[model samples]
Target: MPFLTAAVVLVGALGLVNLLLTLGLTRRMRQYGHLLDGLEPAERGASTRPVGSDVSPFTATAVDGTVVGLDWFREPTLVGFFSPGCSACKDVLPGFVAAAATKRALAVVEKGPEPADEYVEPLAKVATVLVDDQAHEAITAFAVRAFPAVCAVDSQGVITETGVQVARPSAAVPA
Candidate 1:
């Protein structure tokens, strides 16, 4: 009878230890989720180049080998930085394309080993689509660290708005 009592106590202790480990793992997972949420651009802490900063001068060849330079920003330009694999970039692409209706938007798509014809095609219709295969010069010039980011650049070359995604200007705001 004493041996039986001791065995029962040992089993209960093991079960308590298991419950404590599970609770700890659950708490850690919740903390990790919060960390991920904070990394999202919509979160206040997401990093971006400062507004009102001038784009660094850069020259890059477009997919068609057309030379593009700082002159691209001489007009009020809406520049989008995207990656082929980023789901967030794909989600915001149609809005980016529609905003390009004024002929003032440009998309710099980070090239990968796989062909991105489908993603590039739609933007090509309304915007100058630049496939960045080599150095990612444009991405460096704009200080873009995240995919699906947009900067509203003024005619004078100053960035007016910078965010994770382009906000189509309200009709009241100048196009």
Candidate 2:
């Protein structure tokens, strides 16, 4: 009888521990995710040779074998990241598309190796979808945590603005 009681207590303890771990991990994720929203630049790179500026090297290709350089944007560039299957992505599509209509360069960064073209069609009206096959290197480097987020950069390859969701449907609208 004592052995059975001990076993029940052990099981309960293990359950509690598991629950606590899950909660802690969830909290950490949420905290980190918040960083994805409106991440302001701490410092600027050298003005002449900027790497992650308004026109940085976002390694994604175009349909006609033309490689796109994110850093090549001399105008304001807006970058959005989303999953193809995310419902929230669909919800915000119209707004983003409408906004992209005005921006000179608006690119959508994808998470998978599925090639950017697959997702571009859906977002074509408002964005130039690009692939972040590994996701972490490009998207995470931007510190984005949410499903649908936007970033804007200026001519010098400097990040000027970032938005969480549903701001205003105007690319003419600043980040």
Candidate 3:
């Protein structure tokens, strides 16, 4: 009887420790999630990305190697982060390309040397695309947690909206 009671007490104490540990982990995760992912641009990046603040300003290059900066009151820009390494990016490329015909659309391939011919060649038809030299700038700048994500920014470089799994999106622009 004494041994059984001791065992029971030990089990109960172990369970309590586990419960406490779980709670502590949850709290830490909530508080430190940003450390793992990045800052909050507030839904400014992909849908999977964490959205914070209404807007974020960033500078990106064009396929033609022109530097494009998000302005406050100019025209709207649609930024798309894509990778040939990702299957979803390939799937969404068509819609993104189509949208570029009517609006400003960009795809980040990789920065430095131009992207592979296979990816950039097809995207060139529609997008004002560029390559991301920084592998995770989009994720950090906009908290884009998901891939094949899109963000819309106004002329002033204010991020208006973002979609995680959207094929086509509508954004209001000033005439």
TM-score of each: 0.69, 0.55, 0.57
- As for candidate 1, its clashing pairs are none
- For candidate 2, write residues 98-144 as lDDT tens digits: 77777754555566434445457756655555555543334644555
Mark the regions of model 2 whose C-alpha exceeds 4 Å error after superposition: 1-57, 112-119, 132-137, 171-175
Off by over 4 Å in 3: 1-57, 111-115, 134-140, 169-175
Off by over 4 Å in 1: 1-47, 169-175
lDDT of 3 by residue, 20-77 (tens): 9999999989998778686646524345333234444456556686665444226776
- The number of clashing residue pairs in model 3 is 18
Best-fitting candidate, measured by TM-score?
Answer: 1
Candidate 2 shows a clash count of 6
Q: By descending lDDT, how would the candidates be arranged?
A: 1, 3, 2
Q: How well does candidate 1 match the true structure in TM-score terms?
A: 0.69
Q: Count clashing residue pairs in model 1.
A: 0
Name the TM-score of candidate 2: 0.55
Candidate 2 lDDT score relative to the true structure = 0.60
How many residue pairs clash (N, CA or C atoms closer than 3 angstroms) in each of the candidate models, in the order given? 0, 6, 18
Which candidate leads in lDDT?
Answer: 1
Model 1: lowest-lDDT 10 consecutive positions: 39-48
Model 2, position 64, has a per-residue lDDT of 35
